[model samples]
Target: MSHHDNKPPKVCIVCGMPLKDKNDYPGGDTSLDWCKYCGTKDGIHPYKKLLEGMAKFLQQTQGMSEEESKKAAKQMVDSSPAVKMGKVKVAE
Candidate 1:
């Protein structure tokens, strides 16, 4: 089997959220590339600002510490394919 099999998604390309299982979040399928908060079967869930909000989301939802959440959010965003391709900008 490939390395992808049985492994949960690492991160989201559109919103930079660390994804878990397909049903772990409300709208995500995990079988896809982005998280439920960022996308759904129909289309993307639009958001204006992300940098701070992502960190806040992680903290509030996952119980990550303030500093840890910020750091993790930054890392995910910086490495996402969408960001690399200029399709998304967390700071904007």
Candidate 2:
């Protein structure tokens, strides 16, 4: 079965944006195309971006040349709920 078959249909966890078509999320999962108003709400988008970036940095850098630093960063990133909320941008 496809990945989508296992998980429930995608919806914005915060704003209930329907993830059903290209207009909703042109780039698919990574698009993170929530309702326009929700995506632009004060202190939401930027914070989300920051958290997402941190998580990505941690995940990618983990167990690399600087193991300790990587681990520490990963720990910090994983500890924050916000960092875990955003969908990761998958490479195309």
Candidate 3:
């Protein structure tokens, strides 16, 4: 189970963006399962594939180095609401 379950449902499970943050989509509901970037009709992310993208995003947005982002990205993404809710799974 994901460790983010106890936290508020404020982060996008797909992109790992804080739903209440300034980056939220204007005129769109933040209550959705994901943010504007990663949030899609599927309401999920291909966990294994998404990890790489997320690492870069974290590098740019959070100011983490690429190496650091790559190392830490899994904890951030795996703790999202989608994973907590069983919306997606790690690829075998």
Q: Which is the leading candidate under TM-score?
A: 3
Backbone clash tally (model 1): 1
RMSD of each: 5.1, 12.6, 7.3
Q: Comparing candidate 2 with candidate 3, which one achieves the higher lDDT?
A: 3
Candidate 1 on 1-92: residue-level lDDT in tens? Answer: 34676766577776646776666454544466666665566644433445566788889989999999988877766676877777665463
TM-scores for all candidates? 0.47, 0.28, 0.60
Clashes of 2: 0
lDDT of each: 0.66, 0.45, 0.67
TM-score of 2: 0.28
Q: Candidate 1, overall lDDT?
A: 0.66
Please report the TM-score between candidate 1 and the true structure.
0.47
1 versus 3: better TM-score goes to: 3
Worst-scoring 10-residue span by lDDT in model 3: 22-31
